[model samples]
Target: MSSDDTHVGLHPDDLDLLERLGRIAAVVDPVPDEVLELGRAAFELHRADALLMSLVADAGAAVRDNGAATASHLVVFELGETSVEVEVARRGEFVRVIGVVMAADQPYAGECRVSLETSASTTTQTLDDGRFAFERVPVGLARLVLDREGDQPMRTPWFDAR
Candidate 1:
């Protein structure tokens, strides 16, 4: 069968098999886009390739859900060898960033600089418990860059506010 045929839909049995396979594969692979596409192709073939078809169907569904789950308004970041947790949230026209820095080792007193590329505003402070929060930022592709004197500045992963 041609790819066009499989794109149409899958047989009931094939769909069931795909769901089961997708569930199992999700445990290991988590996202199975490739598997799903293969299953979709097999479905188009419209041949009685039950075993192969089932595996592919399951993988496809698993990947779909995984993608949806990661789409979030808030993004969190953890740096290596650093005792800090940064949380960024998009609210209407403003983006809020909350930073929690901890003194895991020595006297934890250091300045943190928070910069937002969108607004071109920078906030600096001496960390208390290494924590700081920024509010009233303009929303839209904004980059939150954090920096300390000795340590390198860290950038939060890009995320859409709206």
Candidate 2:
């Protein structure tokens, strides 16, 4: 076929039809508010040169015989020579998170920011020993973001913090 015979652009009718379909879909199956909020949060967390930490281990939250008074879990993430170990424990109606960062190649010498992000709140701690903690955090889906000077930020995958 000749180049002139090929049509690459969509007709005005096609565009209108797509718009109508989108409107109908939205009305029929609307996105949940939580989903939209999560989407926006995820978008905002994006970093072009950030290092995405990989989950290496997760020890499920253990329930104490005394009930929710003392439940705890551990999760670990690593990327190259850097590893982050997080331990989340139940504290009253909320939770407490303690973590330590270990980087063999590049030590976290100076103050580093460690952020614990949940659906409800975002808490940050800055320390030099690669140690950090967050207290009275609401229980929900959570992720960790580690930022060190002169280094790429590291983010952990979202995990349920029940």
Candidate 3:
């Protein structure tokens, strides 16, 4: 090997074949730079958006639900100048959660979505009077993300989900 010489221990035909294959693959199934950037951003957003909320009431805690006999969970999370209150209850095998996102003086008047850890598309709705609900959600890890008008986003901690 000399400073100006460059070679690998492969036949010339082999090198040429490898180069052609690489070119073919690139054209056949190319990953664009924009797609790669989007993928990276999506992953970062998942972490950055999961703004874990503090649990005020845990599952199985003694909580009354509108004078109902069924068991229920009451969880609350307070963010700076904003807060979310969630009540988890069983409608059947699935879970139903009624939640409200309130602020000290500026409640969110936008959309709220419930996402399960195992899901991609989520149950979404525009927050009406600071209230939202998730119906027939499977029993598992779930979180709530709020998108408010003219305000930063907020997400709740993963609840018992059931």
Candidate 4:
């Protein structure tokens, strides 16, 4: 090892500059609390019993009460062989969730049971051609559950719909 290349500590001037940068960034680019929580939840994605799917896309929040076209959220979840796409819409005080399954490579197991798991309530529906919908759902953190035959049920991550 070269003695010239050895550095034991950060320079005082560099430390001062880093501190100033941090202060500036804290004001200009603060991280949201939800983002931090989502990042923490991402760490549990690979758990053995739970099948976690990544969000492929999202449609930003819509303006409230635009006639019958209420605010809606569309999201897609992707795993290796199975992918699910869902549309969540606000139905006055309640919610409506519509979902479709996209199976990759192998043949699908015909049908699966779909459920909406919310902190306030949980609702179930039967899938027809991998399509299901739930009406009059309550708001809160909810996930889509897919119960399969001879296999562990798949659940989408808890999504907060406030």
* Structural similarity to truth (TM-score) of each candidate: 0.40, 0.66, 0.57, 0.62
- Clashes (N, CA, C under 3 Å) per candidate: 4, 0, 1, 0
Q: Residue by residue across 37-132, what tens digits does model 4's lDDT show? A: 886576445333756677788774776574565788888887778888888888666677887887884334476787777654567777887788
Arranged by TM-score, best first:
2, 4, 3, 1
Tell me the lDDT of model 3 at 11.
Answer: 71
Candidate 4 TM-score, C-alpha based: 0.62
* Residue 85, model 4, lDDT: 83
Clashing pairs for predicted structure model 4, backbone only: none
Tell me the lDDT of model 2 at 70.
77
lDDT of 2 by residue, 1-162 (tens): 111223348676766787688889899999999999998677656553667899999896557655545778899999888888889887655678888888884545666898887765677778658788887777777888888878788888887676
Best by TM-score: 2
Candidate 4 ranges with C-alpha deviation above 4 Å: 1-48, 61-69, 105-109
Candidate 2's TM-score: 0.66
Runs of candidate 2 exceeding 4 Å displacement: 1-49, 61-68, 105-107
Error at 90, model 1, angstroms = 4.2
**Structural RMSD, model 2:** 15.3
Cα distance off (Å), candidate 1, residue 37: 30
Q: What is the C-alpha lDDT of each candidate?
A: 0.48, 0.77, 0.66, 0.72
After TM-score superposition, what is the CA distance of residue 144 in candidate 1 from its true location, in Å? Answer: 2.6
